[model samples]
Target chain A: EAGVAQSPRYKIIEKRQSVAFWCNPISGHATLYWYQQILGQGPKLLIQFQNNGVVDDSQLPKDRFSAERLKGVDSTLKIQPAKLEDSAVYLCASSPSDWSEQYFGPGTRLTVT
Target chain B: AQTVTQSQPEMSVQEAETVTLSCTYDTSESNYYLFWYKQPPSRQMILVIRQEAYKQQNATENRFSVNFQKAAKSFSLKISDSQLGDTAMYFCAFVSNNNDMRFGAGTRLTVKP
Candidate 1:
């Protein structure tokens, strides 16, 4: 039942350069998320992990955004200096806990020009 | 601080007819949970139905259905018969019980065949 898995689906940087996104979840799942979909809007929760710690990131963007979920099954989301409103579509979800019902991945369309 | 409102940004069903997409949410936490995600165009993020706020029994799956009105907190989503892959971009989410998640600003359904 392979589901959540993301990486370089699409990306283009320039504004301040620096971008990174990657996720791999859905195998026992334990809650892991990182969303930010801004085309027409609808996804915005920048961080959340239940396995390698972090349960929430308070909308992240702590100056440059960051994320990690190492031992809890792949995860990574970074946006160093990118801007242009940080172009969007960087979803990555997984849940079998922390309330349940979530399974998404196939995003990573950052195009900050 | 949970807020998810999808004031129908777009809608147009014709395939087999039948469409209803609308959502309203602003939590005061009554044991939260409500979702209806579906973002096609290859962006993934699916899971078209979910509702559980004390569950007054309103959550279907087959042709997708949801009309949970927990005290008017509202939560609508009805897509029956409609097809053509049921167009996409329809989100309405909110999860709180301490998890605090939110998403909404979407509703671009168009399944006109």
Candidate 2:
């Protein structure tokens, strides 16, 4: 089976600019996730989706960051007015269900100047 | 809230030798899942091993194994006969029944020839 896929392996933007990242989950997987991993830090959960509906996004920065999983297969994460501290790797993962092990994608490394 | 901690920021081992990475987590929930992921220079997050909190025996995969201590809230990774290909950033993560996954600051491992 194909693993999770992400686009624009690297991205650079100025502070206050806007940026977006895309992800395509594995086929037949019902759960999708977005995580932000800062340099030297582990990946932190940003949002989670079960099909086209959100399961949890309590840790997401709703003020500036938003994500959507349309039709329950592909998803996108956007950050507006980016901050220098936002320079990190954004990872996408998918699982068959809430109880299965997650499969991750090659992350998009975003750098905000 | 759940938090994972990797006290070792970095480690090194000679090829064909063995090394261990330490991790500890804090959580109020009784049931959860713990994971160890590896991120090489390619920046792909690969699941190395996973352990369910209720399980007493450690989980092993080929050259990689985990020491899961439930009462101590600790999980450690032991790499046997380490190879240069093992050089990468290792992260410890946690996921609860609610399906919220949390990660720790990673440990960069270097294998010397």
Candidate 3:
């Protein structure tokens, strides 16, 4: 079975600019997640979706960051009016269910100037 | 709230040697899960191993093993016969019944030839 997939391995943007990252989950996976890993730090959960509905996004910065999963398979995370502190790697992961092991994809590295 | 901590910021070992990375976590939930993930320079967050809180036996996969101490709220990863391919940032993570996951600051491990 194929693992989770993400696009645009790298991106660069200036403060106040906008950028987006995409993810395609593993086949038959019911749960998808997005995480942000800043330089010198570990990845932190940004959002989670169970099927096409949001399960947890308590840590998401709703003011500038938003994400959506449609058809329960594909998802997108967008950051508008980016800040230099937003420079980090965005990782996408999927699990068969909320209680299953998670498989991750190569992340998209975002550089905000 | 749950928190994961990796006290070692960096560690090094010669090829074919062994090294261990330390991790500690705080959670009020009695039943939870712990994970060790490896992120190479490629930036793929790969699952190295996982352990369920209720399980008494430690988790091991191939050359990677974990020492899970529930009483102390500690989990340590041991890499045997380390290889250059093992050089990467290793993160310890935690998740409970609520499905909220927490991650540590990560430990950078470099295996020298």
DockQ top scorer: 3
Q: DockQ, in order, for the candidates? A: 0.30, 0.74, 0.76
A33-86 per-residue lDDT for model 3 (tens digits)? 999988998888899999999999998999999999989999999999899999
Q: Each candidate: how many clashes?
A: 1, 0, 0
Put down candidate 1 lDDT per residue, A1-113, tens digits, no spaces: 99888998998889988888889998989889888888888888788889999988987988998888889999998889989988988889888888768888888898888
The better candidate by TM-score, 1 or 3, is 3
* Chain B TM-score against the true chain B, candidate 3: 0.98
Candidate 2 residue pairs in backbone clash: none
User: Candidate 3 has which clashing residue pairs, if any?
Assistant: none
- lDDT by residue for model 2 (A1-113), tens: 88999998999999999999999999999999999988777888899999999999998999999999899899999999899999999999999887567899999999999
Model 3 Cα shift for residue A78 (angstroms): 1.0
Off by over 4 Å in 3: none
- iRMSD per model? 8.6, 1.2, 1.1
Residue A99 lDDT, candidate 2, scale 0-100: 57
Worst 10 residues of 3 chain B by lDDT: B94-103
List TM-scores for all candidates, in order.
0.36, 0.95, 0.96
RMSD of each: 14.0, 1.3, 1.1
- Deviation (Å) of B68 in candidate 3: 1.1
